[model samples]
Target chain A: MAQTSTLDRGGATPSAPARRPTAPRRSRGLPAWAVPYALLLPGLLVIGGLLLYPLYQMVEMSFYKVGLRQIRPNPRPAEFLGAGNYTEVFRSELFWSSLRNTVVFAAVTVALTLLAGTLVGLLLHRLGRAMSTFVVVGIMAAWATPPTATAVIWKWLFDADAGVVNWALGLLPGPLSELIFGTSDWSGRPWLNSPATIYLVLVVAVVWASFPFIAVSVLAGLKSIPSELYEAARVDGSGPVTTFWKITFPLLRPVFSVLLVLSVIWDFKVFTQLYVLAGGTTNREAFNLSLWAYTEAFSAPPKMGFGAAIAVVLTLILLVITGVYVRQIVRTEDVR
Target chain B: MEHVSRVLTRGIAGHSVWRYLLNSAVVALGTVLAGSVVALLAATAVARFRFRFRTTFLILLLIVQMIPAEALLIPLFLMVRRLGLYDQLLGLVVVNVGFTLPFAIWMLRTFVAAVPKELEEAAAIDGAGRLVTFWRVLFPLVAPGLVATSIFSFITAWNEFVFALTLINDQGGYTMPVALGFFTSQRSTDWGGIMAASTLMTIPVIVFFLLVQRRMVSGLVAGAVKG
Candidate 1:
């Protein structure tokens, strides 16, 4: 969001110098144009060698047969398989299950996270300054907790025998608990056992860890709207729901779109929390694409090429989804 | 309360958490320093200079940011092994820097752009050399942004789980997140130990986040929304 409007207001005095083609680059024995290149070289080298090059290598590896032996210290060359791994992945039921798990988990988690986050954001906006700060700090504690830590905390809380969740549930009246959970005895009921339940825990943990960011972002967007619009709506006897839908939602569309896309991308890439909750990829039923890829590539008797294919597929799906956002960013940059 | 302290102590002593803490600190600090310098230079270039491929570079950063880091794990693992950085803390530092650079550069560009060109020109006219002017005028002006970006890098590197989990095979090399991961995966799960270790790992990030929450919320939203 490098809006030059802000910059123009801040530096209105000497803005002309910024646009000059021959701006002062008297930074020693370097040519003017070479200065920028020199400044960019180290960053380019790191991103090129690590990010871009590895992306290329991943695509390349997807078409090969790579394993632990081929990746050893004194490595043997990987045999080229020419899309064999992709075909095999397509043929496997595990791949389809993992894909389903990934998509379903992302869909549920994104919806819940946004809904909770937007409500919290609205509350924060309505509160007094000190109250908002107090609430925000509490939320930040949740938001800033590492994913590993979040999973661990949630896992312990939902432990079969000693978990606070089951204990609290058991304290509820029998018929009410049964009505809600289909049983009064949540005692010793394992929340992380099946694919469905593991995803349930994963959703709670992820939504807890993620919603703060969305809340903060939404709050910021809400703060940017002019209060006069709300006052006028109130004068017209608009209900809170009507006002929000008509004014707030339309005004914050850009922020909402960005947050929606980011949440999808993040939920799609959920790895650490799932890995921990599903107990290190042992539970095949709970495996999302990330866990599936890691298990295939890094576990014993590793099929690195097969894993690469899964990862490539995941990347392509993400790229296609986020391509519009990237184009929008580029257009915004052009505007600036 | 007393039992909690004892459990926390046992968790720390039993798992060699001090070692992991030291590892996380080293990796996070390294990432902050290296990521800041590299990102600052690039941000300055993008903000100040109208260079060729400038728009392309900006677009590339966006695209790179969109790709999940987990997807690159397979090839990066091989590349790290080939580069002889496998299983090393420095390797994690390098990876974290690579991951954090794009956002850091994007955030810092606004800061650099906000600093008026006139101040630098005045410094130059007053016989301040390029390096001198940058250090004196530009760097101080961008220090708040630097702090924000550094904190971001610190949190990212400190909390990084996937890369640390796959890359480091040795127990001694395990960072805090990886170390906490072991408590969950073990057959006889120690809930107290896990909770204590999780608290230990989470405290620093929460503290840092509270210290800068006001600036960070606006900065993050502005950076994301405006871009």
Candidate 2:
């Protein structure tokens, strides 16, 4: 939000640089931009060293044949295989299936989380201060918990034989049990084995993990709307739903769009839940691209180059998602 | 409540819960303490100064936020191993601090900047030193920001699975995430036990957020709106 206002303010300042003493002075020895650039150097260096270089190495490794053989003391001659790794990835059924699963997982998770988050946000907003504090705290707790621990907890809850979910389901009256389990035997089905089941479980876990941020973001947007707008709507004899449709929803669109794009990008890269849920080995078809790439890199003799290729592909997808998010945020800001 | 309690207690033994709690606390506390110090100093410098590269530094911090932690796993692991930090809690703390510093600085900078500069200037005109002005005049105003960012840093560090899995090998030294992984085996995963452990693990984070949520909300709105 400040990005738009800050740019406008930044433009106006250059016209009257002489008026404000606090304004940055251009020294004779150094160029005007040098001060700001110099302040930025340490941060730039750290990011370049820590983030950019590794990214570069990943791209390079994707094209070269480097693995256990390359780890040897003398090292074998590494050859540029061009897009051989990418070609091999495209040809592999595991890669295609995982990519498909990843898209489905991300899309479904974003949809579910957005639905849950928006409802909760509106609930808390309507409830005003009554249940707001308690609900907010509960949501934030889910948001803050470590993913590994959360994954473990959900895994147990969904356990076939001894899990609370199945135990609770069994408590339901009559032939519903027979319908769920088939016959009176009534044991729960293995959830992680089937692609459909695993996909559903992953979606639920990811939604639970991510929804709080959306709720809070929406809540923030809700707070920004002047109360006078609602008061004016009420004076016109508008019902609650109509008032929300006409006034609240339109104002929240910018924030909602931003949250949706962020959730999509975040959900696509999810690894911990799927990786843990599958117990490190399941239908490779059920895996997302992140886990698939990880297994490729570190399982057995290790296909580092191939893994790097998958990682590169995943990175490109993330970049595309990010580009869309930035463009939408910029465009919406311009409209305002 | 009774049914929930029964479900929680059914399969979990006492010793494992205690062990898991201990491990989680150690990792979480170490990460928060180390991360806060780095974030505080860095945020203070960037917020208060008008140095040449300040804008560049801020932009760089934003870009760093975009790089996923997964991408840095291998390089960080290698760096830690080289430093003889592998398998140690200290190593985990170091890495968590490094990972959280950019966010901490970015978030904290907004709160620090929001403190009226006039207050600090008044203190300075009265012949107060920079350190005194910061400690007496500025710190109190920014305390909420510190709490919010510290909670964020703690959550990120505590919840992290990838780096913990990569760096630590000894079960005793393992953080909660890696320990959770050990619940699964070739034969069958101990679903009940895993769930109970996970539920237990989530409790502290829940409590921590509950303690800080009000402050966190204000802090987030202030930071984002200001930025």
Candidate 3:
């Protein structure tokens, strides 16, 4: 490193000019063209081994007969089951119900998240900077909290005996509470026990966590829209609702699409919140695809093959939904 | 609110919530430390250089971002166990890095690109070598963007649950989010303790948000609007 030492000694001089690379310096050690690959090496290896390889294995495992006996010590080799796992997965009633639950949960949550997120986004856009910042920070707290933490918070909020929701309901006039929800008894309502009510709570938690992203995205989109458009609408004496439908919605269509596809993918695979809320695999009927797959593979006498099948199905569904969205994105990118 | 301070004075599953806090800190910080370096190097490369697979690389990062981490749960757990990293905080860090690295690199590239190329040439013209030039000139310029990416990694790793649950079987190794899961069961629920633990888990993220809130909004909007 004489060259290095010389450079250092030279660099110690405050007036030294930074050395410029010429022909000889360009030929040193690694070629310039290989530098990018070198930079990408570590990240690619970690992701490939951990993400891509495991994904391939997951799909492969779906085609095998992978029970506990095949996995533990003194293990027997796994036998290839071809479409056997798929047949079983398709035939199982629980699988259908879980799939149904996944679809319904996704549909409802996506709609709610977009609707609420857009409203919040518009509110944030329309408000004074100080008020917007205040609300954005408030919403950011919910968004930044860990998913499991959000679940815990909401679970407490809906607690049957001590929950604020029930407590507030109790404060409402007794006959009104009875006539509206058909339950005057707000305390000890067992909100998490039933599937329908649990989904209601789940929707709240998912929407609460999700809306901030959409809000921020839409706000950003709104910020990008020219003031001229709004001024033009004002000049035409357009009403606020008409202006939103004619200008805002059409302009934000791409952002909405991205948000919709993402929300669908996220909501369909929801696991931790449901798992925490349900307390385990005990509530079979409340299962979403992700949790259902986890239980199928990792529950006692783990049926890994069947679990893989469920995952395969889940991945395929997501791929199809994401496919259409990606095509839209790609086409737009091409146009740009 | 009471539960937050209550946790400060109580333990859960035979360990203080402080232990889980320590575990989460290890994972979060470790992920940020390792994830940011790799991502920064890659981002600098992708941002400055015209490489053969440049567009493909950027697109791959977006595709990876889209893949649901949950779909890989069973397999990632198996990989961690096979590596003999199960029930370990290091495993959590590694997985977090892998998942978050693409996003970090992708975001940081925008920041790196925004830095003028002439600055690098000027640094070279000033006697600084490759690494020093980067540290002296590029690093400070990109620090705001790097901070944004670091926060993202910290939050993602800190709050991650499913991997923590499956990877760390032992109670002692559990992250706070996983521990929060244990507070509820079919037989009984510890609402107070759970609330306390969850609140504790959320504090660092909120504090972090306040620190970087303004830059993060502008950085995200600038990069994503055209996108």
User: Over the stretch B1-227, how does candidate 1's per-residue lDDT look in tens digits?
Assistant: 45347544554425567778889999999999988999999999998888788888887887888777888998888878878899999888988899989888887787788899988766554545557778999999989878887887798899999999888887888899998888667633667666777888888998888887776666677677663
DockQ per model, Cα: 0.53, 0.23, 0.49
- Ten-residue region with minimum lDDT total, candidate 1 chain B: B6-15
Pairs in clash, predicted candidate 3: A17-B126, A18-B124, A18-B125, A18-B126, A18-B127
Which residues of candidate 2, in runs, are more than 4 Å off? Answer: A1-46, A72-79, A128-130, A168-186, A327-336, B1-27, B49-59, B82-84, B129-132, B186-192, B221-227
Going through the candidates in order, state the TM-score of chain A alone for each one.
Answer: 0.89, 0.85, 0.90
Q: Please give the ranking of all candidate structures by lDDT, highest first, separated by commas.
A: 1, 3, 2
**Clash pairs detected, candidate 1:** A1-B226, A1-B227
Ranking by DockQ: 1, 3, 2
The CAPRI category of model 3 is medium
Better model by TM-score: candidate 1 vs candidate 3: 1
RMSD versus native structure for model 1:
4.7
Candidate number achieving the greatest DockQ relative to the actual structure: 1
- Per lDDT, the best of the predicted structures is 1
What tier of docking accuracy does candidate 2 attain?
acceptable
lDDT of 1: 0.84
The 0-to-1 C-alpha lDDT of every candidate, in the order given, reads 0.84, 0.70, 0.81
